[model samples]
Target: MSDHPMALIYGGTPHRFPMLLVDSVEELSEGLGRALKQVSANEVLLERFGDAPPTLPSCLLVDALGQVAILLLRERDGGAASVWYLGGIEAMTFHTAIPAGSVLRMEARVLKRWRTTARIEVKAWIGAVPVADGFMVLSQRGSGSNE
Candidate 1:
């Protein structure tokens, strides 16, 4: 493991939850990364309403992709000192819901990079079946809030 403090996910607060589902970093490179999410039925998403639908939400997939970017940032430099904001998400498609007890494998490839902005293609799967796929545009923050 690198010296970067693997905080898992960086965007959770006193009230936020689902968006922090990143389990770990499996593989990392300068501009690409593969991440994982080990799902347990005890997650907040499954327990949100005593049975809303036994599946992982698509929103969580975005979190996985975002974590890939964060990992790339960490792998590039020591770690991201400033926040990386997700500027845009496009071509997102959800084909299946990752249920509990499944291992979610996520991979992100750097499509383009220019100083302060980056484009990435993200895909996530459980076993042989793909669950989510999307393109995300990220911007490196200089000195501002992600509001």
Candidate 2:
């Protein structure tokens, strides 16, 4: 791990631009966290819904949840030049269309970790109702086709 120390920065730098869903990193421990994602009207574009009315995509919700897992993982490990992909996404369900402008709370828990892969459980909710839930698989960047 070189000079790397155990640390966590709540939603910093590149994470804040473009596809930032989790807003405040309220709490993070042992690669587990409860974060918030404030959705703007811009993020809830009509085009994303296609023929459907304006709403957040299930994939985007998954993306947000996955990013949180990535952030937590990188914090425990260290920043990597390579990118990670959604090696697999399963058991995902969308209960309601996340409103364009609303703060959605998300949670991610690291289930397991190995030499080159990690599995994390993810979930999102707009208040008491569940918005989305899934698992994400992350890997090193250049080591895969991602680069």
Q: What TM-score does each of the candidates earn?
A: 0.79, 0.74
lDDT of 2 by residue, 77-145 (tens): 545544455688767777788877768899889888876677889988888888888778776554333
Please identify model 2 stretches exceeding 4 Å from their true place: 1-16, 44-53, 78-82, 142-147
Relative to the true structure, how large is the alpha-carbon lDDT of every model?
A: 0.71, 0.68
Which prediction has the highest TM-score against the true structure? 1
lDDT of 1 by residue, 1-147 (tens): 334434434421111355566667777776778878888877777535475646677776677677777667545645535556789999999988778789999998888887777888999999989898989998876433422
- Against the correct fold, how does model 2 do in TM-score? 0.74
Over all chains combined, what TM-score does candidate 1 have? Answer: 0.79
Specify the poorest-scoring 10-residue window by lDDT in model 1. 7-16
Report how far residue 107 has shifted in candidate 1, in Å: 0.8
Which structure among the candidates has the greatest lDDT? 1
